[model samples]
Target: MWDAHMHCHFSGDSDASPESMIASAMDKNLAGICFTDHLDYDYPNEPDAFLLDFESYEKKILSLQQEYDGIFPVNMGIEVGLQPHIADQNRQAVEAHPFDFVIGSSHTCDRLDPYYPSFYEGRTEEAAYRRYFESILENIDTPVDFDVYGHLDYVVRYGPNKNQNYSYEKYADVIDEILIRLIRRDKGIEVNTAGFKYGLCAPNPCPQIIRRYRELGGEILTIGADAHQPEHVGYAFDQIPALLKDCGFNYYTVFTARVPVFYKLPD
Candidate 1:
């Protein structure tokens, strides 16, 4: 198994150290894992914003690679929040690193994090959802500089009106545009299973969107648990093969030096 997205203590929001996370992956018999620590730049309101110490973190990851070479394949990765107005700053930060994988994410919409209820103040649930999707569409056109876009529908998982009805089909046009832009830029998308943990039937960028991406000439896809804790690593990975097969994707993607490499899903 390959867990393409995860975080360790090197990231601010996570407390799981690299050693502990590697041990968990080893216990699960994963073939490889990537440490995609948070790298959100200039996120307002987060004083000690969740971020990784890139220089030191990369050094430590390289050291661990030597120690665990025979046990499992470990890769250095970073998860960066791609905010529209700060694209330049975010791009500069990523260019400074020698990451094996990069996951671009959008955690804030219009400078407000939907994770906080205040973001939805005075706005109807439908409007709030629409704004979130718009934010994604806006950022998609701003020269993305990462391997894959993370949890495209992450806002839904924490929306104020959680049970509100919304699906990819409703925003297929916008999503198609986003996928095409990514494909043109040689970027990929991730199937984040964290959605299931939040009571949703499917993960972010639901199966419908996955199918849409494939239909739109997208072949590279990555599966991630978006784990913040050791136990969460590789969660529900057993179902990934079948899911990819169902979406007409025979291969899953990994990265090294920020370049994508494909792996056939085990039969």
Candidate 2:
């Protein structure tokens, strides 16, 4: 399997070096991996925090790719934080780079990042969750450049009660709109295993959403660990094959130079 979403020191939040992350993926026997470091322009309270230094970051990735050539495949990718206002900026950022894969993600709700407890203050969890899903719809409605939507239910990971009160059924209307729009746009979603790390006991968007996506004629699906460190590189990936099969997917996807490559799920 390939761990398509990963971060290194290039992503402001992660301290892991790219080499260490690739080495860890190798140790785990992954077929290949992608380095999707963050390029979250205009992050709340820290606008420049996740801005990627493309020159230096690309240099390091190129150097390592040469050294590890034939040993393993290290694909270059980025995770862009999507917002309605900065849709043009996000598109420009992706166009300027030759990233193999791009993950468009909603990291904020009306400029407020749900990561902070303050985001949940004074609001019912259901209300906050609805607003988050609505923001995703707005983001995708714009012309942002991205291949897959990252962590469809990321906000729930930080909600006051986390996923305890969350269910795809509770918010099926908006979520279905999001899925249908994505399929129409030829976009895909990633099964982010980070949810398991955050105590959700399932991947982001959960199995229910994945099954719904398939039912909606969504064909492109990617699986990623969303790892920021070596140990987490491919975290819980072993459970993916079975989980995806249960969701009506017999294949998983990877990207190269922005093109989808399908691989049959291992039996």
Candidate 3:
């Protein structure tokens, strides 16, 4: 019932307002939503991309939460772009704010924005993908105190083949390493439904990876539409409960004040 990850005008890539997005979620029969606006510390995005005015932004969301008090909980959250150099800054920002949920995401590697094609220059797709994974490993190695890693296989969404030949069997070693570390550290992953919107035919991590996470004893899985606009709020979520159950999970996780709370998957 909670669209755990979404964006608004606060996110560099989205121009939708938070109120409009919340209304759309309500229309979809959602109980709540977390505004995970982007906070990419440094990048080449336009109009000062990936930056948030923490003070102003916090005040705005807190006000919005008060406005929607009796209607539903509008949780304050952020999608942080994981850059090793900015990890400390990120920590400080989170400490300064009252974010209910934080999604650590990798939008770049080797100082290159993967959203652009240049990231694939001078390397095979496999090497590029490996480097992206390596960057994620490094960020997580920052010994992240984050709740969940967003879009584990996000790189695949922009790959030249776009998951046409993508298979868990192909990337098992590194993927397993990633999953194992997350489990060992008590962190979790999200079922980012954005992949379906991106025409990837699956979620950001896809079912194969989700099943592997469950198989490896990783239990704190969360679900998020990752919607950047109002119309996309709670997109294709009714299908996720069965998808999650098939992946060996009966409940999905949520957060409040960074504490995990599990809710049974809907029938």
Candidate 4:
């Protein structure tokens, strides 16, 4: 199995050390894994905004690489929150590192985190949902700087209203536009299974979106547990092969130097 998205202590929100996460993946007998640590730039009021030591983090990764070379394949990756207004800075920071994969994510919509209920304040449920989709639409055209876009429907995981009513059929036009942009830019999308841990019936960028992406000439896709802890490393991965088949995708993608390489999942 290949898990293309994950976090370690190098990221602000995670506390798992790289060694521990790697050990967990090895225990699960994964074929490969990527440590896509968070690289959020230009967020106001972020306590550790300038405290992430990339040099030290890279050195640690290098050390671990030598230690685990024969046990499992580990890729150095980073998840960058791409802001339209600050794209230049984010791109420069990403270039500064030697990453195997880079995941472009939109965690902020109109400068507000959807995780915060304040993002929904003063807006009707429909308006809030529409705005969220609009933000993703805007993010799609920003630039082509990463291998995959992380958790396209991440907002739904934290939205004030449950995502029961937010089906891809309801937003096909917008999603079509997003998929087209990704295809044109040669980028991929991720199937984040963390949503299932939140009691959500579907994963992030749910199966419907996955099907839509494939239908729209989008072929590259990656599966990630979005694990922040050891036990979550490869959660629900057993169900992904069948899901990809249902979505009309025969291959799942992995990356090196931010370039995608496809793998055939067993049926």
Write down the TM-score of every candidate.
0.95, 0.99, 0.96, 0.95
lDDT of 4 by residue, 1-267 (tens): 798888988888889988888888989888889988887776656735523578988888877878878878888888888778878777787888898888888888888878788888998766776787788777767753788889988888887666867788877787788888888888889999988887677788989999989988998898899999989999888888988899898898989777778899966
Model 3 scores worst on lDDT over the 10 consecutive residues at 41-50
lDDT of 2 at 122: 90
**What tens digits encode model 1's per-residue C-alpha lDDT throughout 132-203?**
877877887776588899998888888765636877877777778888988997888999988877877677
lDDT measured at residue 113 in model 3 versus the true structure, 0 to 100: 76
Q: Report the alpha-carbon TM-score of model 4 versus the true structure.
A: 0.95
- Residues 143-220, model 2: lDDT tens digits: 987999999999999999999999999999999999999999999999999999999999997999999999999999
Q: By summed lDDT, which 10 consecutive residues of candidate 2 come out lowest? A: 57-66
Which of the two candidates, 2 or 4, achieves a greater TM-score against the reference? 2
In order, the Cα lDDT scores of the candidates are 0.85, 0.94, 0.87, 0.83
Pull out the clashing pairs in model 3.
Answer: none
Stretches of candidate 4 above 4 Å error? 47-51
Candidate 2 ranges beyond 4 A from true positions: none
Candidate 3 segments exceeding 4 Å error? 45-47
TM-score of 3: 0.96
